[model samples]
Each structure stands twice: as structure tokens, then as C-alpha cells.
Target: MNGFAATLASQLTSALPATAPLIKAALRADPGLLNNCVSLTRQLERLVYEPFQAIMKGDLLKETISKGPFDIVIDGLDECEDKQGVEEFIDHLLDFFQEHPRIPLRIFIASQVEQHICERLEDDRVQLCNLDSHSPYDDIKKFLQVSFCTAAKRDRVIRAYIQEHGEWPMKPDMDMLTEQTGGSFLLASTIFKYTIQPATAEDPTTPMDRLPFALRMNGR
Candidate 1:
């Protein structure tokens, strides 16, 4: 998450060199932007904090407003290299919100449970959800069906298989694979990728046989 923030800051600073001073001033002034720097700062802030805030505030209506709230969606925080920067970034963010209690900014972060990030984000305003707890089987099945259907439309053999079989490994097959996946979207996607690999003369398309292999690969 910190890495993302740094990248964002670096990009914004590179694009608008005057943004840093402006943002600092804006933080001092009101909950919104004042100058061009403030404007850029708000833009940076929006990039990191707006989407979740919009959802939380239920402000889905897209209307032109003089000033808007900040929301952010951050994923893969644990993968970020600079731990100290991430901590400082989060601290400043929390401090900003602490100073301005009514600022309509929210942040949604998705990451594997890492101690430093989790500990900092354990504040009352933060809402934590473990991705492992979410059932991704249905999501994976739908995704696979869509991808396969799209691919089959382009590939003659896949299309012929679907036509001859009356259904291309239909819903039940998808469900079984989903169950086998144990709710890991990554695992399911890897399985799908392996299953769809082009068959050679020696190895005909036996996706069922390949499923076990995919699962084993995932276990590693």
C-alpha cells in the first residue's frame, strides 16, 4: 500500500512539481483544495481514497460538484518493498482524517495479512476483511465460463467440442472444478490456463486428467 502511495506521489510530483507544497497547504486550509497544488493534492488523494468512500457514503450519483470527497482502493500491500514508507504514508493519511473528522475520504486496501500494515490499520474507522474467508467458487466458475465461451467462439476445435458435446463442460463441471479449487481464484485461473493448453499428437485434450496436475502445481 505504501509503495502504491509513493508511486502515486512520485507520478503526481513528476507531472505537477508544485503539488507537494499545495497539498501541505490544503491540509492546513480546509478539507478541500485551495490552489493548483491543492488541486493536484486532491487529485492524488482521490486516486488513493475515493472509490471506497463513494461506496461507503452511497454517493453513486455522478453529478458535477465544486468539491468532492476522496476515496482509494489499494491491493497487494504486502508485496510492497518499502515498509517504512508504507507505514509513514498510512500514518499521514490517518493523521489527516483525524484532524478533519468530517472529510468524506475512505480507503479500501486488499493485501495478505502482514503485521505492520495490519497493526497500523486497526483503528476504529478501518474495516478489515480477509479475502480467504470470501467464497470465490461462483466467481471463478462465472469467469471460467465467460473466458471459455469467448475462446470457443474463436477456436474451431473448442467450438466443435461444444457443439458435439451439446455443452462445453457445462455448469456442473465448472462447479466441481470450483469446489476442487477451494475458493482460490489464483488456483482456479491457473487450472483453467493449464486445462486450455493446446494438445499435441501424443497428448490429446484430456482436461479432466490435467485438473489433478493443475491442483498439484497449485499446492506447490
Candidate 2:
């Protein structure tokens, strides 16, 4: 199995203890499948698909699904370095769903739009939603507020500034910063770190000085 698949399998096995015995059973049936030289397809079949089938046969899949929905969340598919492995994984995943139409498993994948991923997931079974359509301003603002509050307790510079100036990055300043970030968590995180980073010998700037500079740099 590839790194991504290996990680996914590990997480699934850890999360679902019942899979352990099924995996052990498969490995006992064919010890060679555990070898590193084994093909990804064979490894997946033995380790993942077979165990899932076992669970289904044991009626655990039905019992679990009867309670409610079961979702497997995979975050940042585009970030994985192995593009071919990702494609292969997606192919196998779609094939699994197609083969087992009765399986009530929902795979929630969060990824940036890439041609390979887009092409593979453009199937009728997949429901794609653009996350950018959702407003992230409130979430960003909360993150920034919590971050600054925590920093104020830790950073001596910020503490000193707060003592002298009532409150650093007052509500209006925070509102402006949140607006400037334009609902992008990445931008909000970058600006937060840039503004509150500790003073360095090469770039000696306190959070007090940098906060306003950050606001100006991002066109307040």
C-alpha cells in the first residue's frame, strides 16, 4: 500500500477495533499479503475491503448504519505528494462503492480542485460542494480572538501593551482585520503569526508594532 493508503488503513483499524480480528484472519489466510512487496490492490483487498466485507457478513455494518450515518472524513487530498497513488486510491474507492451499492458508507473528502481528482469524482454518486461558498468570517474572527487572548496571557510584550493601552487589537481593529482576511483561514493564520511572532535579533518587532503593520500591509 502507498503512504496515504497505509495511513488510512491504520486510522481505520485503530478507530474500529472490530477490524483487528478480521485483518488478522486475512493475514493468517495469506501471510504473504503482509509483505511490503505486495501490490497496493492486493494489500487493500486483504486489509481493508475483506475486513469491511467480514463486518458486513457479521451484521455489524447493518447494525451500525441502522443507528445513523457513518462517515469517513479524509482531509487535504490535494496535499498528498503521491498523485498517482491518490488517483489509484480514488479509483478503487469508487469501484468499491459501485460494486457494493448496499453499503451505507459515506466518504467525505475535503480537497482543493485538481484536474485528476475532479475528473475521478465527477461521478453521479459523488456530491461536490464548493466550501468557498460558505462564509468563514465568524470562524476566522473567533480563532483570531482566542489566539490573541491566549497570546496576551503569554507574551510579555502584548501584556505590557494591554496594561498601557486598555486592550490591544480592540474590537474595531479585530473587525477590520477579519474583514481584510476575506474569509480565508490561511490568510487569517498567516496574518496572526506575522503580527504576533516574537522579536528576533534580525527582525526585532513586538506584537504591538507588528499588529498595525499587518493591518496596513493587508490594506486595512
Off by over 4 Å in 1: 1-6, 9-72, 96-106, 201-220
TM match of model 1 to true structure: 0.58
- The C-alpha local distance difference test score for the whole of candidate 2 amounts to 0.80
lDDT string, candidate 1, 67-106, tens digits: 4544456678778886775676677777767875665555
**Each candidate's TM vs. the true structure?**
0.58, 0.62
Cα RMSDs of all predictions?
8.1, 5.0
The per-residue C-alpha lDDT of model 2 at residue 86 equals: 78
Q: Which candidate number has the best lDDT?
A: 2
Best candidate (score: TM-score): 2
Residue pairs with backbone atoms closer than 3 Å in model 1 (clashes): 1-77, 48-72, 49-70, 49-71, 49-72, 50-70, 50-71, 50-72
